[model samples]
Target: MFDWTRSCAYDEQQKRRFHTTARSRLKKLAAELALPPGSYDVRSNKAGVAVSGEVTLHHTAVYIQVGQFGMSSGHGILIRTCKGRKNYTGGANHFVALSMLDDIPALAAAVRAITGVGRADADSADRRAA
Candidate 1:
C-alpha cells in the first residue's frame, strides 16, 4: 500500500535538502574564486574592507577589488580591469551581493567582458552564457 501524500512530503524534503547543500557549495566556491593564488592588499574603508589584487584572465592583467561589508552582514566583490574608474568609486557600480554566490561566476564573466579583458575560458564562460 503506497501513500501518495507521504511520497510528496518526502520529495519536498529532498528538494529542500538539495537546495541547502547546493547553496553551501556555491558559497565555498565563491570564497575560493574571491582569492586567487597571488598577493593582495586589504584596506579598510568606512563602509567595508576592500581587497585589491591582480588577476590574469586570457593572458591579460586586470585589477580586482573584493569588498567585504563591515556595517552589514553581507559582503560583495568587485573585479575591474581599469584603475581609478568612477563607476567603481566608493564601491558602487561593480557590486554583487555575497549572498548570491551561486551566480558569482556569471557576474565575473560579465565584468571581464565589460572591462575588455578578453573572453574567459570557453567552458567556464559557457555555463554563464547559457
Candidate 2:
C-alpha cells in the first residue's frame, strides 16, 4: 500500500532540493563562462533554475534557454532557442540532467552550440572564403 499524500510531499521536497542545487550550479557556470556583465540572466525559484542569454551567431541574434527541473535520473535539461519566430527553431527534449561539476565541459559545449560563440566565427570564415 502507498500513501499518495506522503508521496506528493516527498516529491515536493525533492523538487526544492533540486532547484537549489541547480540554481547554485547555474550561477557558477555563468561566472565560469565570464560573458559580458548583464549579457545573460540567471533565474531560480521553487520551480527550477533557468539561464537565458543572447548571442550573435553569424550576424544573427539568437536566444538560448537552459534549465533543469525535478529530481529523477529521468529528470533532464530543457534547452530552447529562438531567432525571430514565435516558436523555437530547434531545441533539446527532456533527456537527462548534466549539471555535475564533472559534466561542466559537456554543459559548456552545449552552450557554445546554442550560442554559436567560438564555432560561429570559424564557420563564418569558411563561408566567406567559399
Candidate 3:
C-alpha cells in the first residue's frame, strides 16, 4: 500500500516491499532465461509522491509498467517493444500489456527483446557474419 498523500509518497518499508515484489517477478523470468548475475537491475524513478509509480528496465529507448496495487495498471506487465516482437497489435513504441501468469512465456520473450541481454550483440553478429 503506497501513501500518495504523504510528501515522499512512500516509506522505506513500503519501498522495500515494492522493490521485492517487482524483483521477484523479474527473477522468475530471469531464472527461466538463465540470465547471468547483474544482467539487469531494477531501478526507481520519480512519479509524483509515488516514487516508482513508473519503472524502466535500464533502457530509455523502451518503457515498461508493472501493474500492481489494483490500480489501472492491473496485475499485468506492460512493455513497448510490440512491433512484431509478440502477438501484440499495438502501434510501434506503444506498450502492450501482458497481464497474467499465462503470458509469462510471451513476457519472457518481450523482456529478452527489450533488454537485449540474452540476444546476440554486435560483436557476435559481426563474428557470425565474418
Candidate 4:
C-alpha cells in the first residue's frame, strides 16, 4: 500500500536538501570570487532555491540571480542579469540556463572575460595619461 503522506514527507525532505545544497554552492562561489561576506541573499522560491547579488566584473556592474528548480537530476542552474535600476523597471538584460551542477568553471570564465576587457580599457587609459 502506497502512503501519500509518506510521499509528501519525502518530497519536503528532498526540497530542503536541495535548498541547502544550492545555497551552499552560491556561497562558495561568492567566497572564491572574494565578494564581500553577506553580499548575497539566498531564498526558497518556486524553484528549489535562488540566490541574488551584485557582481562587478570588469567595469560592468550587474545584478545576478541564480535559481535551481525541480527534484530530478535534469534540474539545472538558471542565471539572470540586470544592469542598473533597469532590473526593476525595465527587467533583466540577460538570461541563460546551464544544465550542469559543475557550472562554476563556466561562471568563472564569464567573469574573466568581463574583467579582461576592463583591464584592457584601464591599460589604454594609462597609456593615454603617460
Candidate 5:
C-alpha cells in the first residue's frame, strides 16, 4: 500500500511549514503594510519545497517563486503577479536575489505599487469577509 494517509499528512505538514515560512517572511511586510497576517492566504504547488517552489498569496493577490538565482545559481525569491514577473535580481523594479532568507521590504513596496491596493483597504476587506 502507498499509505495515502501518511502522504496526505506529510503534504499538509509541508504546506503548513511553507505557510509558516511565508508568514515569517511577510511579518514585517504585514506590519509595514498594516495588513493582518491572518488575512493573507498561502498556497504552494511544489509540496511546499523551500526551494524552487511556487507559493501564491491568494487573498493578498501575490505570487512568490523561490529558486536558483540567475547566473549565480544561488537561492532567491522571484515574485510573479499582476502583469510581469520580478526576478531575484534585475532592475529597480525587479526582485532581489537572495543567497539566503532576505527581508522583502522593497519587494513588498513593489507589490503595493503593482497591486495598487493599500493594506488598510485589504485589511478592511478581509475583515468584511470574516
Candidate 6:
C-alpha cells in the first residue's frame, strides 16, 4: 500500500523550506559582495526569488539574473548574464547561462574580477591594466 498523497504533501513542505533558506542565503551573499543595497530586485516566484542586478566589470556593464529553485531539502541556482543594451532586450537574450551549482563560486569570482575587486596580490597590475 503506497500513500501518494502524503508523499506529495511532504515534498511540497520540503520545497517551501528549501526556497526560504536559499532566498536568505542569496541576500547574504549579495551583502558580502558589496553590491549596493537595493540595487538588485528580488521577486518571489513559484519556485524561488528572481534576482536581477547590474554589475559593472572591466568597464563593461552586465545585467545578471539568478533564478533559484528548490529540490527536496536542497536548492539550485541558475545564473545568467546579458550585455547591457541601450534599449530593452527581449527575454532569452543572455550571453551566458551557468547551470552548475559548483560553478557559482567561479562565476562570483569572475564578477569580482570585472568589478576590479578580488584580484590576487600579484595580479594587481592586471586589474590596473583593465
lDDT of each: 0.38, 0.42, 0.47, 0.39, 0.46, 0.37
Q: List, residue by residue over 49-92, the lDDT tens digit for candidate 3.
A: 45546443432233345533333444345555323223233324
Runs of candidate 1 exceeding 4 Å displacement: 1-60, 70-75, 83-93, 124-130
Model 6 Cα RMSD, 1 decimal: 10.0
User: Which candidate tops TM-score?
Assistant: 2
lDDT at position 16, candidate 2: 53
In terms of lDDT, which candidate is stronger, 4 or 6?
A: 4
Model 6 whole-model lDDT (C-alpha atoms): 0.37
Leading candidate by lDDT: 3
Clashing pairs for model 5 are 88-96, 88-97
lDDT of 5 by residue, 10-124 (tens): 3556545544565456555546556556655544555434333444444344444443334254434555443222322322333545422343555566656655533544665
14-130: candidate 4 lDDT, tens digit per residue: 445544555555565454445554444444453322322122221123343443322243324433343433343223334434333246545544543433211223544598799
lDDT of 2 by residue, 57-104 (tens): 111223333333233452345544444434445544323344333355
> Considering TM-score, where higher is better, how would the candidates rank from best to worst?
2, 4, 3, 5, 6, 1
- Consecutive 10-residue window with the lowest summed lDDT within model 4: 51-60
**Per-residue C-alpha lDDT of model 6 across residues 15-104, encoded as one tens digit per residue:** 454445435545544544455644554444443223211221211133343332233323234333433333234234223332322344
Roughly what TM-score does model 6 have, to 2 decimal places?
0.41
Q: Which stretches of candidate 2 lie over 4 Å from their true place?
A: 1-9, 45-75, 83-96, 99-102, 118-130
Error of 6 at 83 (Å): 6.3
TM-score of every candidate = 0.34, 0.47, 0.42, 0.46, 0.42, 0.41
lDDT of 1 at 25: 38
